[model samples]
Target: MHKTKISVDNIVDNQTFIPNYPIKMSIRDVDFFYGSQQALYNIHLDIIENQVTALIGPSGCGKSTFLRTLNRMNDTIPGTSLTGTIQLEGVDIYNDFSDTSMLRTKIGMVFQKSNPFPKSIFENVAYGLKVNGIKDKAIIAEAVEETLQKAYLWDEVKDKLDKSAFLLSGGQQQRLCIARALAIQPEVILMDEPASALDPISTSKIEDLIAELKKNYTIIIVTHNMQQAARVSDTTAFFYEGVIIETGDTKKIFTKPIKQKTEDYITGRFG
Candidate 1:
């Protein structure tokens, strides 16, 4: 294992972990709340460009809450509010765009369960393009094919493009949803326990797909599976009770966390 030159001396009081690359998104001192209850507290994280950043913790640790905050998905709920700055490429996403549709398109999301549309497989991939106002059928068809290929689901469903998306198996359906997300060509992808519902084989497939996707897209994934986070992420952040304890290179975070709290959680001491 390669140990980084970064030691306690360079970190934020030897707790906050930062990656060694240019940040695609910078989240600074963010706090989020639903009514009177606060779910996240002063989160400071950096997502590197064109790499997979994994968020791991026990349930209700605000990992998912933080993920939704990336694209402002939490705004859909009533009485939820956020304070602090979240910037993409130095531009404040919330302040820059009054209409979040463009933001949602720029940062796509995939959920824990496979939620394919009732429409045909082709239409599922084309939905984003259509909604974004691509009127040409040929363009949409080409995009669907390209996106399915990019999602690694083209071969399985190429012959069945006209069939309903619900006809696919659980794993295939998840990949279909990924294809849907990719159709719009998002710059960032946020996944919330994307493979938590699949079998081992299906989970392996998603893991491998995530590896391939990061070559082109910046990805931030929230996963309960420690092994999955270690397998696919370049950087990892450990969250507990709305606070980020550590964030660093995945190898370092898993193999040699600077914080005792992170070490205890990673070693199976307690969630």
Candidate 2:
């Protein structure tokens, strides 16, 4: 495992390996509303490049809502609005970036449930490249193999490229969706409880794949499993009632949380 010294801006000098990578996404004063209901409140978070940042809390605490705001995924819902700025590479996504398609390509998403397209394994991975206007068959084919290898799914499904994606096991389907996301060569990957439905062995595989992926792609994951967050993330944020209670290094957040609320929640107390 490699470690980067913590940046002076983070103010956590106690941790040995708090990432000093540049901020990949900067979210500030973000509030999200669905019609008359408010889901997130004045949220501020910085996602480090090439590191995993986990959003962990009980259900309906705005963890997923905050994750969607990173790539403007929440804009799809009707009667929803957001206030405040979310910047990717210093450009405000909500106010300045109008091209959602290109934004999505740079920041891809994987949902809690595996949502593989109704196509063959090869086509599933090739779909994004084709949609983005890559017409050359050789190029798409090469990209598919490289992406599947990145998602750690190539060797397992290499010989069955023609098989329908639905024929795969649940874990394989999730990995396939991840491969599909990677096929576009996104800069950041947002995962909403990606391994929540998997068995322990499958969950371990996903965790390992995440570890490997963070070497190049910045990752922001929303997970309810504290143990999973502790195991995979470089940083962790605890949300409660739509507000972030604590955010910092994963080890400190789990072992010596500065806030009592964070400690109580992680200790299996009332959420």
Candidate 3:
């Protein structure tokens, strides 16, 4: 796996590389279950502010499950329960926060497959803003344009704002979804394999957008692409069997992992 150098300076010691940023989200002793089956156990992770943290693991390893927990998306599923604290900016998401819609506004999500509503391109981006009760047409229009620009898609679709979102290509559709997520001005973005369904060019575009977006948003991504993880993330967490085996600077984790499983998985010895 190729390792990208991190922009932040870290004080490296024999044991760990200490990141400089404050923790945006803190997960301590987190456990998740679905219908009596435990999917995660004793999970602890610190997501740094304005950084990209990648979660990589094999299939059914609970990385996506853990992602959904951040925004309480799992609460929609029956027989699902989560124990332990997940705090965003020092506020316990489960205990202290009662407004799910508000919490989700601060933390937005993009899925593996691009899901665009059967609406016009402009409406798709403006949906969240409208739902949030922004009634001023000029304000909503500017926000939509700004969000599309942030998603690196304004120039492509500017002439066709009234067009159906389904008329766009697969890559354009995915970026439209991203623009939709960004419309709410979320502080953190959760992406579950955002580029997995796209071609190489589109995937590269997504990676580049991620690097730029981290300047303003804390990003957490669950991806099976090890190289993509190494390339885009400042920190990397290797999850095995629903547990994080090791997590640290992306460079260290890819070059010299502390765990045998991490090393083996990164080296493609096994999943």
Candidate 4:
């Protein structure tokens, strides 16, 4: 693996990355409400290109709610509405010109549970490509192989491509879902408690995979596990009661948080 030294000064002096490295997504004064109750306050944050950002907070803190908003997943819920702007590559995703399907293709998502289709492993990974109208079998096969390799699951299931995806272990299934997401060539990957359902070993594998994936894809993970957030994220944002309380370097958030609420929560004093 190739390693690069990223200057901390660059991260501190500018919330944005250097020139030639434009941000992939930006959220400006975004608020979300379900019917009459607001789930997220006026939240403003920027997602840097090709970096891992973690959302950590107690349950009902709106971490997951905030994640879903990025890809317009919240639109599926009736009576739920959004106020303010969420931009992908400088264009508002909520605008009239925005295509929800195309936006979803650009911004893929992985849920907490490994919900693979009840189909062959090959078919599961190729489903997205097929939906996108890539009819050539060779093209689909090549994409499936490349995506699986990128997801770190090719070696395990390469020989059994025709086997049912359900036959794979929990960890393998999660990686397969990741492969499925990558098959569409997404720019950002949103994960909502993706490892909570897996065993310790499986969770460790997923964490390691996320660390590796940051090189090629922007990742935002919502995790209740402080240690997992610290292990996998470069920046950590602490949310509470539908607001972002604090966000900074992961080390600082864990060891020396500036806010009382952040400190209390990290120290296990309260939710």
Candidate 5:
């Protein structure tokens, strides 16, 4: 990982987050269920435009479940349901946008493991463009290259656009997946432990990419790595047993948390 000092001056952090910053998305009184089991409690959160907000907690704390709710990924699961409202820039995702495909285009997701199509690297990124109805070959080609560059993978994979995505290393495959998500020009990127499966160097590159991407896209990341959250997120929300324990500046959450559970979890006392 890139060695960088963590101090107030080194961060653009939550304290400096203007109260007037536009809200990119909102989650209000959200409750989630998987069959008979309740997952998320009355969850309320705001995702700011051009900022990285990280969700952190121990295993099965519903951080990942809540991240999926933003883009309605849970809809695929049988007997799953969500209550209350989730809005993207004041538009109710459930009511205003019945076109789930468009919603997904606006908010793309990267999973825990890198998932590439059984095709060439170029085709992997081009797949999203094709799905979005871009038929022009020039446009698709330009987008594939541009997205790969934005993902910081163009240099490594540029010579092998025709090569199979499966042939790439795990880290490269993850970046390819990120490039695939970027090809759609999504406004928000939801990452669930995106760097967890990678080596340290690759993980650092992904973190650096996250920092750059947040200048154009709102990023919500779910991470079990507290250090990664501290480095990449402007604000951090700590979740426990499906409820938010505390949400605040990354500095405060790590250095001086308001809640005991938040402190304990961050200090390695308990989950």
Candidate 6:
């Protein structure tokens, strides 16, 4: 087994690093279960505000499961239970006083598949704002434009805002979904394999967007692509069989992993 050194700063490249942001979220001794089977171990991690943290591992390694716990997305699954502390800005998210719906508004999610509702492009992005009772049309329109531009989809679909979102290509649709998420102005965005279904060009575009997005929103992504994690994230955490083997800066995790298992997984020796 090849042993790799683990260091935290290797995850984010200094050239693209942002400065002076606070710690946005923290996960301490997190454990999860689906019915009677536990899916995650005693996981502890910190998500820096305005930076990207990538969760990388092979299939069924609990990366996705861990992502869902951050925003309480796991509550939807029947018989699912979580026992741990997930904090947002020093407040415990799992506490009884923590409102799940309000928590979700602060932490948005983008899925692997583009899941636009059966509505026009304009309506899709406006849904969240409307649900929150923002009745000013001008404000809504301005926000829609700003978010669309941020997602790099404004120029492509600017002329047909009334068109059905399903009419767009897979990549465009995915960007629209991102725009929808951005419309809510969530402080943190959890993405599970956001680029897994796209072509090389689309994947590259998403990666670039993620790099840019870290300046505004803290990001946590679950990805199987080691190269993608290394390229886009400030921090990288490796998972194996429901355990976090090692986590640190992306460079060290890729070039000098602290554990033999992490090195093997990253170097293609074995998953």
Tens digits of per-residue lDDT for model 3 on 135-224?
A: 999999999999999999999999999999999999999999999999999999999999999999999999999999999999999999
lDDT of each: 0.88, 0.88, 0.90, 0.87, 0.88, 0.86
Q: Give residue 33's lDDT in candidate 5 (0 to 100).
A: 86
C-alpha RMSD of each candidate structure in angstroms: 5.2, 6.0, 5.9, 7.1, 7.1, 4.8
Please name the candidate that would achieve the greatest lDDT relative to the true structure. Answer: 3
Each prediction's TM-score against the native? Answer: 0.93, 0.93, 0.94, 0.92, 0.93, 0.91
What digit string (tens of lDDT, one per residue) describes model 5 on residues 1-271?
A: 1122223232223433457778899887788889978888777777889999999999989999999988989998899999889999999998898899999999999999999999999999999889888999999999888999999999999999999999999989998998899999999999999999899999999999999999999999999998999999988999888887777777788898877888899988876
Looking at model 5, residue 169 earns an lDDT score of 95
User: What clash pairs does model 5 have?
Assistant: none
Query: lDDT of candidate 2 vs native?
Result: 0.88
Runs with alpha carbons beyond 4 Å of true place in candidate 5: 1-18
Clash list (residue pairs), candidate 3 = none
* lDDT score, candidate 6, position 91: 87
Question: Which digits, one per residue and each the tens of the lDDT, describe model 1 over residues 1-271?
Answer: 1122223233342223343567799998788889978888778888899989999988899999999999999989999999889999998987987889999999999999999989999999999999998999999999999999998899999999999999999999999999999999999999999999999998999999999999889999999999999999988999888888788889988998988989999998987
> 11-53, model 6: which lDDT tens digit per residue?
3223224356477898877778999788887777878888899
**Where's the lowest-lDDT run of ten residues in candidate 1?**
1-10
Query: Candidate 6 — which residues are off by over 4 angstroms?
Result: 1-21
Model 4 scores a C-alpha lDDT of 0.87
Positional deviation of 195 in candidate 2, in angstroms? Answer: 0.6
lDDT of 4 at 214: 90
Q: What shift in Å separates residue 59 of candidate 5 from its native position after superposition?
A: 0.5
After the best TM-score superposition of candidate 2, give how far the Cα of residue 146 lies from its true spot, in angstroms.
Answer: 0.6
